[model samples]
Target: MAEPDWDRMMQAAQAGDADSYRRLLGEVGAWLRRYYHRRLPPAMVDDAVQDTLLAVHEKRHTYDPARPFGAWLGAIARYKWIDRLRAMKSHPSVELDENLPVPGHEEAVSSAVSLERLLAELKPAQADVIRLVKLQGFSIMEASHRTGQTMSLVKVNIHRGLARLSAMIRSRNDAG
Candidate 1:
């Protein structure tokens, strides 16, 4: 029947009163859940509420005692809700792992071992260049830095290494 004393609760909370702080956060969280439910999907309401509450907890020190607590809380909640909406729009959820890649595992190890053996067939410099750039995902600049080679030399090694690897694979395929 009475309006909740938000300012008093918030002031008490700011003064280090644990019970009031807990009560304020609980009430705010409940209110935010209801507010979010009207605007967001059911699954998203709880997440928004939790995020808003966490922001409030983290930014509590910024609260000015003279200001209306509801306004401050509303500002935080509004931003959080908007952020959630933006995230939802930007990253629409997909039912991932419901269906696995399920690739054939029969030759997985043999393929890896075979690839390693193929690399080993090249000169060590060529093998190292290919492994650094192609296999290990290092940038050309990084590979050059790691191997103490110049940028031009790194490029040359990568080109030569790839050509050699292609010939090796082709020879293997032709023989097999």
Candidate 2:
């Protein structure tokens, strides 16, 4: 039998020919193993190689057939390696609020309006600092940089603003 043409095998595989896919995989599997081993742990190399091949199979439609098949395959393998590395480095045990209940939309809206009214009662500087550091999700350092204010001043303004707003909110709730 004539030696198998690799380019022909790749082309056939791209066209969804099962035999050509198997042949190509068998031929390239060793190279893929070496490729992955250079980047991943020995224990992870086989799984990474398998995942890369599977991703290549799944995303074959996105491949430009005009491009060199090896280049496209290499790109897929690189991305899969990155994904594996990210997964390995990630801490799965996140510190989440298990006891926190989901707030309803109405409750969220009312709380937002109350906060807005409270913030509006403060002086512009106090309101701006509080909104930047608290309401708008900015860190204290970020709020300081954005407002061109000192960190100590920003902290003081936010503390006093929040205290005043809290007292006002409590008084309003009592009167109602």
For model 2, the stretches where C-alpha displacement exceeds 4 angstroms are 1-4, 91-176
Which residue pairs show collisions in model 1?
none
* Each candidate structure's count of clashing pairs: 0, 0
TM per model?
A: 0.50, 0.47
Model 1 weakest lDDT span, ten residues long: 92-101
Which regions of candidate 1 deviate over 4 angstroms? 1-4, 94-176
Residues 92-159 of candidate 2 have per-residue lDDT tens digits of 21122232235333433454565566568998788888667554557778888988889988877776
Candidate 1 global lDDT:
0.64
User: For model 1, what is the alpha-carbon lDDT of residue 152?
Assistant: 80
- Model 1 residue 55 lDDT? 93
Q: How many clashing residue pairs, candidate 2?
A: 0
